[model samples]
Target: MENNIASTDNDQRVRGYCAYDWGKSAFETSVTTAIFPAWFAYLFMEANGISMKVLGSEWTADAMFSAAVMIGALFVAICAPSLGVIADRRMIKMWWLRVLTILGSVSCILLALSPYLGVSVGWIWAMIMFMAANVGLNGAGVFYNALLPHMGDESEMDAISNKAFASGYLGGGLLLLVHLLMVTFIVDESGSVQSWVIPFAMASSGIWWLGFAQMTFKMVPEPHIENEMEPMGLIASTKMALGEVKKTLMGIKEFRTLFIYMIAYFCFIDGINSVTALSGVFGIVVLGLTVSGLIATILIIQFVAAPAAIGFTKLAEKWGTKKALQFSLVCWCFVIVGALSFAPLELENHDEYDIQYTWDEGNNTYVATAREGVNNIAALPDDGEQQWALEYEDILPVAENEDYDGGYAVKWAYEKDGTPTQVAVSLNATSLAALEGTMDESRFSYSISGGEFANSTGLGVEHPTSLGDGKLDFIPKTARSLVWEPLGLSVFFQFLLLGVFGGALLGGSQGLARSMFGQMVPETRSAEFFGFFGFFGKVAALLGPLIYSLMTVWFDSRVGIFAISLLIVAGAIILRNVDVEDGIAVAKAEDERNRASA
Candidate 1:
C-alpha cells in the first residue's frame, strides 16, 4: 500500500500529512507557548533590567516578543499570496513546505545557542531566531493548508482537517508532558533546575519536529499540474506570479461566495486567537494563577481539545461543515460571556496584600509576603513560598528589582534580636513627596517587629494599609458578589470549567472553519486562494492582538475581552449569509474548466 503512497485516495499519504501536524505542534505547544517566553524573559532581564528605552519608548521582554511575532506575521502576509501563485503554477508546494520546515526547525536549534552568547547578546539572538522560527511556521502553513483540497474531496475534508488538528493536540501534549517532567526533576545540588535543561528542551523540540516531519516528506508526493510552468529566473517567475494574483483579484466576482465566506472567517478567527492569547495573561495578572498552574491548565486544554476536534468532525458529517462551524462560533460567544463573569474571591489574611512587609509581634520577626508585584520567587515549581519571615537580621531577603518610579535606592532590612528591624530606604525627593502625599492614615498601617525601633526612632518601610487592589478590582468584586458566590463556584474551578469548555469549542471551530474553506476552494486554484487565506490569517494575527492591546490600555482587560467577543458575534452574523453550496459548485466548475482547457 506504500507504493505510490502519494495517490489522492491513499490513506498512507493522509497519515503522512497528519504526521506533519503531529511533528510541528511540538514547536507550537512546547517551545512557543511554554518554554520560550520564560527563557526569553530570563535572558532579557539579565541583559536589560526590567525594561529598556528604545526611541524614547520603554520595551519589556514581552513587548519585544510581541513585536517579533508581528514582524514575522507581516513578512508572511506580504509573501504568502504571491508565493502560492508561484507554487501552484510551478507545482512546487511540497518543495516550499520542506524548505520552510527546515528554516523553522533550524531556527529552533539556533535558540539553544543563545545561552552561550553572553547576556548582552543572548536576548537579541533569541529575538531574531524567535522571529525566524515564526516566519517559517507561518510561511509553511500556506502550502500545508493548500494541500487540504487535494487531500480529499468535499465529503472527507472535515474529517481530514479535524483529524490533523487532533493529531497536533495529542503530539503537542505528549511532548509538553516530557518537558514538564524534565523541568521539574532535572535539578542540581543547589536545587536549581540547571540552565542547560531549558536549552536542551529548546533543542529537543526542534529535533522532534524535524525528525517526525520526514514521514510527510517520505510519503507525500508533490501534486502534479497538467500545465506546469517550468522554472525561470527568480525575477521572471515572481513577475508571472504577481500577474496571476492580479488576474485572480480581478475575477473576485466569479468566486463571490468564497470571498464572502473569507470575510466571515477573518472576524471569527481573529476573536478566537485574541481570546486565546489574552486568557493566560488574565489568569496570571488578575486571578493570581501561578506559572505552573497556567502550564497545567494549558496541558488540560490540549488533551481535552484533541478528542473534541474529532467529535466536531462527526458533527460536521451530520450537520454540514458550515452549520457545525456556526454552532462552534455561537458556543464561543457563550464562552466569552463566562470569561467576563469570572472573579477571584476576596483575599483572606496575608493574601489581602499585593506586597506585604510586617512585624510579627509575638514571634519577634519581620515578615514579608510577596505576591502579585514581586519577581524571582525562589522555590520549586509548585511551592507555597509566598510568605517568609526573618527572625533577626539576615543576609538572604527578597529584594525588589524594580526601583521606585523616580529612581532611588530602597533596601528593606531586619536587624538584631533586640532591635528586630532596621529600615534605611533611600528615597529621592520626588518619590518621597509622592509617598508623603498619598500616605493617608487609613491607606497604610504597620507595627515594628521590636518596640525599640518604632518606640524610639519611629523609622520604617512604607506599607499600604488597604492593599492588593487595582483600578478594575470593582469589576471582579461586583461579579463575585452577584454571580460566583451565588453559584458556589470558586474562581479556580470557574477558570478550569471555562478553559475546558472554551478549548473544546476552539478546537472544533478552528478545524471546521478551515475545513469549510477547503471545501469551497477549487482544486486547481487551491494554493493561490490559500495564499490569500494565509495573508488574511497573518494579518488577523496582528490585528486581533493589536485590538486587545488598544482596548486594554483604554479600558480594562475585561473590556478588551468584550471588544473581541463582538468580532465573533459580527462574524457569526456574516457567516449565516455565506452560501457554502454555491461556493462548492463554483469550485467544481472552475476545476472542470481548468481540466477541459488543459
Candidate 2:
C-alpha cells in the first residue's frame, strides 16, 4: 500500500511540475514573444517616432528592448546563487516559486495600463514593468529547475524534462493562437487593428500563467531539506548562503567535467536565448512584418516545438543525449546564419508621383493641376514591348462637370526599338479643372498602384544594406535582396519556414541540455548546484544581449546578430570536450558521500 501511494505521489508530482511549465509558458509566448514586444514597439513608435534618445544617443525600439532584457538578466545572475543556496538549506523552494510567479503575473497584468499612461511615458513604463516581469520569470526558473533531480531518476530524466517542455509549448501555443485570432478580427473604423487589443492580450497571458500554476502549488510538495540549518534572520541566512556558494566555487575541481559543461552551456545557451527573445523585435524592425505576422510565426514555432521536443527524447535514447544536443546546436548555427541573410522584399509599391501643384492665391491653398491634359498622371519610359503600366484610383469630383467623367486613358510615352509606345490614364479637362478647384476645400484624396512598372524597374525596396554609417560600414552587404523573393513568396512565409526549422531544434536542445545536467547533478545538493547552473545561464544570458545591444548601438543590428553566431560556435567547440560519463560518476559518488556523512 505504501509503495502504491508513493508511486501515485511521484506521478502527481511529475504532472504538477509539468503544469508549472505550461503555466509560465503563457508568459513566455503571449507576453514575451508574441504580443508585448510588438505592442511595446508600437507604443515606442507612437511616442518617440521610431527612435528614442538614450544617454544622448539615438536608440531604436529594438535596441532599447534588448537593453531592458539585459538589465533584468544581469540582476537575476547576481542573485540566483544565494537564492539557490537558501532554498537548498530551507524548505523555501515552493514559496520562492510562488512569490516569483505572483511578481511576474502581476507585472504582466499591469502592462495593460501602458496605453493609458500617455504616449510620452507609456513605453518607459512598459519597459520598466517588462524588466520586473523578466526578473520574476528568470528568478522563478532557478528554483523550478532545481526540482528536476527529485522528480525522477537519471534514466527517466530526458523523458520527464522533454515532456515538460512539450507541455509548455502546447499551453503557450494555444493561448497565443487565441490571441492572434482576437487581434486579427478586432479592427477599428479605418480597418486597422485597435491598439488596446494587444495590451489586453498581454494581460491575458499573465492571468493564464497565474491561474494554471495552482496545479503545481496543489500537487508538487516542497522537498525536505537534508542537513537542514537552524533558522536564522534574513541577513544571517544571506551571509551563510554566500559562504556556502564560496565553498562550492572553491571545490569546483571536484566536478571538473560538470564545470566545463557549465561553461559551454553558458556560452551557447546565451546565443539560443538571445535569438528567441529578439526574434519578434527583429521582425518588426528589420523585416517590417506586422504584429499579426510575427504572432503567426511564433505560433508555428510553438506547435512544431512541442512535438519536436518529444521526438528528441527518442533521438537522445538512440544517439546518446550529448550527441543529440550537439546536433541541435549545429542546427542552431545554421538558423542564425540564415537569419543574418534574411532580407525581406518590399511587395507593396507606393511611389510618390511628381504631381505639379500651383498655389491658389484666390483660396490660399495648393492646387494640383494637370501638366498636360490629365490632372494627375504617372509617366514611365515605355519600351517597345507593352511591359510598363500605370494604375490609379477612380476619381470623383465634389462638383459636377458636364464635359468630364471619372475615366482616364493609359497613355505611355518614350519609344523603344523605333516604336512610339504611349499609354496614359487621364481625367477629362473639366474634372481636372474641378479637382484643382476643390484642392483648397479638402474634399479629394488620390491613390495610385502598378505592378508591371515595379517588375520592369526591378526596384523592390530592400532593407538598408549598410549597417548604418559606423565602424562596421565596411562590412560587405550580403543581404540586400530578398533570398526567397525570386520564388514569389512573402517574407512572412520565409519567417514561418525559419520558425519551423528553429522550433524543431529549440525545445530539443534546451530539454536535453537540462536533462543532461540533472543527470550529472547530485540529488543531495540539487538546489545548490542548480542554483549555480542558473547562475551560469543567467550570467551568460547577460553577455549575449549586452554584446548584441552594444554592437547594435556602436555599429548596427546586423553586426550584433553576426556577433551572437560566434558565441554559439565557440560554445559548441568547447562542449565537444566535456566527458559526460565522468561527470555522472562524480555526481553519484558525491551523492553517496553526502548520504554517508549525514
Candidate 3:
C-alpha cells in the first residue's frame, strides 16, 4: 500500500514537471515565435518606416530583434552557473525557479503596454521587456533542468524528457491556435486588425505561463540536499557559489567526456537555437510572407515537433542517442541550405496596361500619365511614397458588353540605378476603379517596395533611380534573381515545407540531448552540473545570435544563415569523440562516492 502511494506521488510530480513545460510553452509559441515578432514588426514599421537609424547604423526590424536576443542571452550566460551552484547548496532550486517564472510571466504581461506607451518609445519598451523575459526564461531553465535527474532513473530519462517536450508543444500549439483565430476573425470596420487583439494575445501568454506553473509549484517538492550547509547571507552565498564554480572548472578533467560533450552540444545547439529565434523574422524579411502565413507555419512546426520529439525517443532507443542526434543535425544542415536556395517566382498576367511616366529631376518627382485618350494626364508627386503608382495611365477601349478579365494589373518593378529591390506589388482592377473618380493621383499607387520584386513588365513607370542614403540601396542584383526563381515555387510555400521537415527534427534533437546529458550527470551533483549545462547553453545562445547579427550587419542575412550551418557541422564533428557508456560509468562512480561521503 505504501509503495503504491509512493508511485502515485512520483507520477503526479512527473506530470507536474511536464505541466510546467506546457504552461511556459504558451509564452514560447505565442509571444516569442508566433504573435509578438509580427506585432513588434508592425509597431516598428508604424513608428519608424521600413528601417531605423540606430547608433549611426541602419537596422531592420529583424536585425533589432536579433540584437535584443543577443543581449538577453549574454546576461543569462554570465549568471546561470553561479545561480546553479547556489541552488545546489541551499536546496532552493524550486524557489529560484518560482522567482524566475514570476519574473518571466510578469514581463510577458507588461509587454501588452508597449503599444500604449506611444509610438516614439513603444518599440524600445517592447525590446526591454522582451530582454527581461528572456533573462527570466533562461534563468528558470537552469533550475528546471536541475530537477530532471531526480525525476526518474537513467533508463526512464529519455521518455520523461521527451514527454516534457511533447507536452510543451501541445500546450504552446493550443494557445497559438487560439491566438491565430483571434487575429484572423477580429478586425475593425476598415478591415484592419483590432488594436487590442495582439496585445491581449501577449497578455494571455503570461497568464497561461503563470497559471499552469502553479501545478509544478504545488506538486514538485524541493529536491533534498544531503550534507547541505546552513544558509548564509546573500553576498557570502554568492562568494561560495563562485568558489564552487571555480573548483568545478579546475576539476573538469575528472569528467572529461561530459565537458567535451558540452562543447559539442554548445556548437550544434547554437545553430538550432539561432534558427528558432530568428525564423519568424527571417520569414518576414526574406520571404515576404504575410504575418498570417508565418504564424500558420509556426503552428505547423509546433504540432509536428510534438510527435517528432516522441518519435526521436524511439530512434534513440534503436540507434542510440548520439547517432540519433547526429541524424537530426544533418537534417538541420539541409534545412539551412534549403533556406538559402529558396527563391520562388510566380507572376501570372491577367491583362496588360500601357502606363507612361515622366521624371521631374528638379523635385525628384516621378509623374505618370493618368488618362490617355482624355488628354487629362494627372501628374503624381513621389512625395516619399514607397509604392508604385500609375497616376492616370489610360486603359485600352473595350466593348461595353464584353467581359473584362478582371481589368488590368500593371506589374512594375522599381529599380535604383538598374538593380531590382523590394517585393513587387501590383495596382489591380479594384485599386484602379477606386482611383477612377478621385482627383487624388496618390490613390493609384500600391506598395511594391519591400520584398524581392520579380517581374519587370516595362510599363515605363519612372520610379526613383536612387534611394538617397539608405543602407539597402545597393542590394545585389544576383541575390534577387539567382537562387529560388528557377525552382518554380513561392518562398511562402518553401517556408511551409521547410517547417515540416525542420519540425520533425527539432523536438527529437532537443529531447534526446537533454536525456543523454541527464544519463551522464551525477545525481548527487545534478544541480551543480546542470548549471554548467545551462551555462554552456546560454553562452552558446549568446554566440549564435551575436555571430548571426554581426554577419547580417557586415554582409547580409543569407550569409548570416550560411554561417549558422558551420556551427552545427563543427559540433557534430566534435560530438563523434564522446563515448556515452564511458561517461555513464564516470557519473555512476561519482554518484556512489558522493552518497558514501554523505
Candidate 4:
C-alpha cells in the first residue's frame, strides 16, 4: 500500500505539470487574451466612451485596458513574494492553489454576465474580475513554475519547459476557437447566447481546477522540514519575508544584470502589449473595419501563429535562442509599420449615397448630374417610386410662397431606374480647368445612366486619383498590394524562424537554470528559492505594462512595440553573458564564504 501510494504520488507530480499548463492556458485565453478584452471594449463603447485623464481627456479604450493591467500588476508584485514564502511554510501550498484557482475561475465565469449588466456596472465588474483573475493566475503560475525543478532531471528542464509552453499555446488556442465559434455562429439574433455557454465555460474551468487541485494535493509532497519549530505569527512573518527579500537582493552577485534585464523586459514588453490591445481598435476606428472583421482577423492570427509559435522551438534549437528572439523582434517592427501605414487621416472621404428624402408631384428641384443633373438624385430610403413625381411640397423656393412654377417653370427630368444612384460633382482644380460645361473624365471614375433627360450622355470619371502627396513620402509606403501588408511572406518567414530558434534557446536555458538549482539548493530550500525566482521574474510585470503603456501613448502603438523588441534583444544579450558554469562556481564559492564567516 505504501508503494502504491508512492507510485500515485509520482504520477500526480507529472500530471500536475500538465494540469498547470492546461489551467494557465484556459485562464489566459478565456480571461486574458480572447474574450475579456473584447467584451470590456464593447461595454466601454456602449457606456458613452472610454475616458482617461491620461490621454488628453479623450476616450481611448486601450488606455482603460492598460490601466487595469497596471493595477493588476501592482497587486501581483506585492502578494507574489509573500505568498511564495507562505506556501513554503507548511502544507498550505496546495490550499493556496486550490482557493486562488477557484477565485480566478469563478471571476472568469462572472464575465459571461457582463453583456447583461449594461455598460456602467458591467464595465466596472469586468475590470475588477479581470484584475482578480490575473492575480490568481500569476500567483498560481509562480507555484507551478517552481514545481519544474522537482518534476524532472536537471538535463530535461529545457525540453520540459519548452514542451509545457507549447502545450499552453495549443490548449489556449483550442479553447479560444471554441468560444469564438459559439459567439460567432451559435448566438441568437439579440446577440445573446443560450444560457449554456456560460455554464459550460464555468464547468470547464471548474473541472480544470478540481483536476489540478487533486494533483497538487497528491504530488507535491509537504515540505520535508515544515518550519514547525515555532513558526512566526502572520505579522512577524511579513517582516521576516521582507528582511529575507532584502538579503536576497543584496547577496546575489548578478543582481544588477537580473534587475536591469527585468526593467528592459518590462519596458519593451509593455510596448508589444500596448500595440496588441490597440490593434483591433485601430482597425475598427481608423480602417472602418466592422467588429466582425476585427474579431475574425485576431482569430486568424492565433490560428496561423499557434503552430508557428510551437514550430519556433525547433528553429531555436537549430539557430540558437538569441538569433531567433532578435528575428521575432524584427517581425514585430514590420507589423507595427504595416498597421500604421494607413492612418485614419489618410483614408479619403468617399461618397456613400444614403437617400434621405424623396420627391412627389410637380416639384421642380434642381438635382445636378455633372454639376447639376437629374440622374444624380438618390431616392429616399422608403421611396418605391420608379419615376418620382416632383411635388410642389418637395420644392423649397428661395422666397416663401413665390411661384417658380408660374414663371418659366424650370424643366427637369426624372430617371425611371428602380435602383438609386449618386453622381458626385466636385469643383476641384481639375474640374475647374476642364471648363464649366466641358465633359472630361476626372481621375475618379463613375458611370451615369438616366433616361428622359434632354441630353442623356455618359460621364467618364477617373479610375483613381492622387491625393496630396509626392511619390517619396515621409511615411514608408506599405507593400499595400500584399495581403498581409507589412507582415509579408518574408516577415512571417522571419517570425517563424526567429520564434522557433529563440523559443528553443530560452526554453533550453530555463531548463538548465532549473537543473542547476536542483544540483545546488538543498531540497528544503528549493521551493523557497523558486518562490524567489517568481519574485525576480515578476518584478518585470509591473514595469513591463507601464513601459508598454507609456511608449504606446508617446510614439504611437507601433513604435512603442518596436521599443519592446529591445527587451527580448536585451534579454538574449544578458542571458548569453550569464555564464552558467561560472555562475555555479561563484554560487559555490559564496556558500563556502558564508560557512567560513560563520
Candidate 5:
C-alpha cells in the first residue's frame, strides 16, 4: 500500500530484498521435498507381507498418502482465512510468523521418532506430525507471499520473484544432496529404533531458517496502516473473515480468471505432490526393491528435477507459461509410459526356480556360492524335513528352503512349514553389491535342508507402449532388474536446470497472485483478499495429492506420472489469463476511495 517498494533510477535497491524468495527455500527442502513423504511410507505401508492380489486391491500407496494430505489440508483451509484477517487487524504479522515457524520446526524434528513406534502406532504419530508441519509451513507461506507486494511493484515483480525461486532451487537441491550422502554413506547403521539422518536434517533446516529470518525482521519495517478500531475476539474475527470472502467473490466481477486459475492450480499441484510422496513406497514395497534402490532413485529425482524446473521456466518465458507447462506435461506422459512398461507383477510358478547356493557347514548358513546360467538348478542335500535356519539381522523374517535351483531363484530364502517361501531374489552378485551399497549392514544366512527346483516367469511388458496386454518375458535376471536404472551424473546437472525453471515459475506465480489481489481489491479489506489466497493455495495442496493417490491406486506408479503431467498442463493453461497490471489498478482505486471516506 506504501511506496516502500518504489523503484529508483539505479534499480539497485537490494537492501530490503532479503525477504525475496530465498526464505521459502527452507520450506521446500525441509517440508515438501525431503522428510515427510519418505517418512510416511517407511511408517505406514502394510509390512506383514500380504498377498500380491491384496496389495494391488487396497488403496494404492499414492492414494493413501494423498488422502492423508487432504485431511491435513482441510485444517489449513478452515484456519488460513481467519489467521490472515487477524494478522492484518493486529498489525503484528511478525508475531504470527514466529509462532508458526516454531510450530513447524518442532513438528518436523519430532517426526524422526516415528520409526521407534510399532507399525500400527508409528504411522499415526508420523501422520499427526506431518499434518502439524504442513499446516505451519502453509500458514507461514501465506504471510510470506503477501509481503511480495511490499517488496516490488508490477515492473520489478518478474525479476524479484524469479530470483527468489532460483535461490530456493539452489538451496533445496544442495540440502537434498547433503542429506542423500548422509543417509547413503555416513549413517553406519539403521533400525526400528530411529534414523538419525531425517530428524537431524530437519532440525538443521529449522535452525537455518530461524537464523535467516532475523535479517528481514530487522530491515523491513511494518507498513503504516491505521489499526481497525473494532476489537473483535478470535471467533468474531473468523466469522467476519468468511463474510468478507463471500462479499469479495460476489462483488468483484473481473476476478473470474483469478478464481479459475486457483482451481486449476489446486487440481494439478495435488497430483504432483501425491506422486512424489508415493514413489519410495512403490519402489520398496510394491517392487520388492532393497532400501538402497529406494534411496538411489529418490536422489536421482531430487537432482534431476532441479534443472528440469529451471529449463521449464525459460521455456515458459519464451513460449509463454502455458506452452512451457505443456512441455513438462509431455515429459510426464513419457515417464508414466515408461513406468507402466516396467510394472512389477508376481510370477506364476514363482515358487519353482533353479538356483545354486553354498552352505557353511560350520555355521549352518548359506552363501551365494554360484549361478551357472538361465534355468540352472543347484545341488542341495535331499533332507526333506530338515529345519533350516533363516536369518536377516532384524524385523523382516527370512524364509527357509530345503531346495535349490541352478537359475536365479530365491536370492535369499529359508524354510517355512517345511516349504521354501521366497524371501529375496536377485540376478547376480553385482546387483546385490549395488543394493548393499545403500544399506547400513546386512547378513545372508540360510540352512541347507535338501534340493528342490522350480520354474518362474515375470509379467513384463511386451513393448513400452503395450501396457494393457497381460504378457510375460523370460529373462535371466535378478530382483535388481526390477529397479529403475540409475540415472547417470548428467541427470544431476539437468535437475539443477529444471529446479531453476520450476522455482522461478512457481515463485513468480505465487508472487503475482499476491500482487494482483493487492492492486485490485479494496485496501481497507486487503486481509480479506489474502484469505482467499490462503484458501486457494491450501486447497490446491490437498487436491493435488488426493488426485495423485487415486490415480496410483486405480492403475500403478505410472498413473502418478500421468497425473503429474496433467497438473503441469492445467497450471500452464490457467496462468495464460493472469494479467497483473489491471488487478493493481483496481486495487489502487479502491484504496484511494477508502482513504477519502476515512
Candidate 6:
C-alpha cells in the first residue's frame, strides 16, 4: 500500500494502522483459505489414500483442517481477554503485536519444508505448522483489535475501520492473484504443477506479512492509557481477568438483551466462520477441484466481498442494521442449502478424471499420468516393506497376439517386483486408437471393493458428498439433472457461482454483525463490551469448525454442512425476538449511572 493508503487521506497514523491489515490478510486469504488446503490434500492423498486410519477412525484432510482451526481459535478465545488486559495495563500493544506477527509469519514460512521432510511426513508436518501459524494469527489479533479504538476519535473510528477493511480486501486479493499466477504458470513440461511453486508462494506470503508490517510498527504509536497498571505475571493477570468475567456474569439481568443478542451472535457467527474457513478444503477433497479452481474461487470471494461489505451499510441505513443483519442471516441459511446442493456435473469428456489417458488432437498422440492406489494391486513400498505393484503387462495387450501390428510396445524395467526402475511405453496414433477401442475401463481403473469409501475410478465418478448421500443424494442429484446439466456448466463454474453468492452474503453478514452491536452498546463501556464482543466472536470461530469436524467424522462432510446450517437457522430465530431499541436504552441508562457515580 502507498504510505498514505489514499492520496486524499491526511493522517499518516491511519495509513499505518491500515497497513497492518493489508499485510496480515495475505495469511488469511492466501495461506489459510486458498493454497494450503489443496496443497495438504495432495500431500495427504499421496501419504494416505482418501483418509488415514487413526483412533479406529478415518481422518480426512477437511476434518483435520477444521480441528486445527478449532484448536487455534480455542487457544486465543480462552486467553485473548487476559492478554488484552495485560496489553492495556502495560501499554505495550504494539510490542506484543510485533512478536506475534513474527511467530505467525515464520510458521507460514516453515510450511515450505513440508515437502522436503519426505513424502510420508509431509501432510502431518503441514498440519502441525498450520496449527502453529493459526495460533499466532488469532493470538496477535487480540492486540491488533485492541489498537483499533485508539486509531481515531469516536467520530472518525468507524470510517477508519472501514478503510482498513477495504485495505485488507485489496491486499489479500492482490496476494492471491500473485499466487494464482505462480501455480498457473509454473508447471512441468507435461503441464503438471511443479513442486517448488507452492513452496515459493508459501514463503513469499510469510515475507509479505512480516515485511509490510514494518510500516505499521513505525507509524502507529502505542496507545496512551490514563492509569496504566504495572505489568503483572501471567497468573496474576489471569486472576484479574477471571474477576472481571465474574462481574460481567453478575450483570446478566442488567444487560439481558445484550446477553441474548450475544448468544444469537455466537451461534450464527460460528456457522458463517466455519463455512468460510473450510470451503476450500471441501472443494478440493470432495469435489476434486483443481488447485487452479480453488484459488480462483477464493480470489473471486476476495474481490466480490469488498463491494458487498459497503453495500450492506446502505442496506442497514434503509432497513436498520438489526433487520438488515437478520436478513443477511436468512440469506446465510439459503447459502448453506445451496452448498449442500453442489454436485459435480457427471464427467463425459476424456480429460475430466484425476488419473486419465486422453488423446491430444493438437499433437496427435495419447498422454497419461498414473495414480498410485488401485484395488490393492497398485501399491508401493511402505515402511521398507514390499507391496504389490501394478504391472504394465496387465494394462497393455500381449504383443504376441496375431492382430498385434507392432504399433505398440510396452516394457517395465525394475530391480524388484515391488519397485519399478523404469517404464517405457510407445504407441502410434492408429495403434493407440485401436488400443483405446479394445481397452476395458474396468481393467485399467479399479475400485475399493469394500469400505465406506468404495469409490470407483473413472471420469464420471460422483463427488464424495453425493456418495455420502447414498440413495438419498436427492437435492444435489435433482440439482445436477435440472440445473447443472441443462446449462452444461462444469463443476468449476458451479463452484464459482457458489462463491459469488456466498461471498456476498458472507461479506454483508460479517460487516453488519459487528456494526449492529456497536450501535446498541454504550460509549462509556466500549472497551469492556467490545472485549466481550471479540470474545464471543473468537470463541464462536472455534465452535462451528469443531462441530463441522465432529459431524464429518461421525457421518459425512455433507452432514457436517447440514449441521452448520441448522446453527444459522437457530441463530436467526433467536435474533428475530431481540429488541434493538430496548438494548440501546439499557446501555444508555447504565452509562448515565456510571457517569453520575464517578
Off by over 4 Å in 3: 1-3, 41-67, 116-125, 346-489, 546-559
Candidate models: Cα lDDT each: 0.77, 0.74, 0.74, 0.48, 0.48, 0.69
* Pairs that collide, model 3: 343-484, 369-392, 370-392, 370-393, 422-451, 423-450, 423-451
Worst 10 residues of 1 by lDDT: 456-465
Cα deviation of 90, candidate 6, in Å: 5.1
| Candidate 5 lDDT by residue in tens digits, 1-598 | 2444444411333343343234445656655555656566645544321111335564434455566666666776677766766665556566666677667667766766776777667767777776787777777666665555555554444345444455555565566667666655654333122356676676666655555566556665554456444768777877886776567668657565446555655655554444455554544433334454544554454444444445444554565444445455445444434333343332222222123333334544433322111211222222211112112212122322333322122233333222333322323445433433423221121112222211211221321111332212111022114432233212223223333333333434433334334444444554555566777766665555556567666755445555666775676566567554455666666667656665
lDDT of 2 by residue, 346-427 (tens): 3333222212333334554333322121222211123221111221222221111222212212432223222222223344
lDDT of 4 at 368: 33
What's model 5's lDDT at 496? Answer: 33
Output the number of the lDDT-best candidate: 1
User: Per-residue lDDT for 196 in model 4?
Assistant: 60
Model 5: how far residue 34 lies from native, Å:
3.5
Clashing pairs in 6: none
Write the candidate numbers in order of decreasing lDDT.
Answer: 1, 2, 3, 6, 5, 4
> What's the TM for model 6?
0.73
- Expressed as tens digits, the lDDT of each residue in 1-598 for candidate 4 is 9999866765566665665665557766655665666557756655644343544575456667777776765676667666665555555566666676767667766665665676568777777777777777766666666566556543344445555655555666567677767766666554566656654664465355445456555556654433333566889888877776667668665444434433443433444544555555544433344455554554555444444544555555665444444455555555555444442222121221111122222343223322122122222222222122122212211112122322213222223332232223322334333432322422212222232222222222211112223222224233333333444432223233323433333323333333434334333334455565555555555554456568756754444444555554554455444334454454455445544543
Flag the better candidate by lDDT, 2 or 6.
2
Give all TM-scores, in the order shown: 0.84, 0.75, 0.76, 0.63, 0.63, 0.73
> How many collisions per candidate?
2, 11, 7, 29, 53, 0
At residue 559, candidate 3 shows an lDDT of 78
Model 3 residue 568 CA deviation (Å) reads 1.3
Superposed by TM-score, candidate 1 places the C-alpha of residue 481 at a distance from the truth, in angstroms, of: 2.6
Q: Report the alpha-carbon TM-score of model 5 versus the true structure.
A: 0.63
TM-score of 4: 0.63
When 2 and 5 are scored with lDDT, the better candidate is 2
Worst 10 residues of 5 by lDDT: 471-480
Model 1 compared with the native: what TM-score?
0.84
Task: Tell me the tens digit of each residue's lDDT in model 6 across 1-598.
Answer: 6854643344777888879878899999889877887788778777776577789997877778778877887887777665665564566788988998998999999999999999799888998988888888877776776666566543344455556666777788999898888777788765667889898878888889888789899888886655567777778878987776678679788888888998999899988888887787677666657666766787888888777776776777677777888898888888878877787776554334333443445565433433322111221223111111223343331122222122112222223222323222344445434434433322233222112222323322233423333433677778888987898877788889889988787767875666556555665454456667777988777678779889888877778888998889889988987888898788778767755664
How accurate locally is residue 98 in candidate 2, as Cα lDDT from 0 to 100? 95
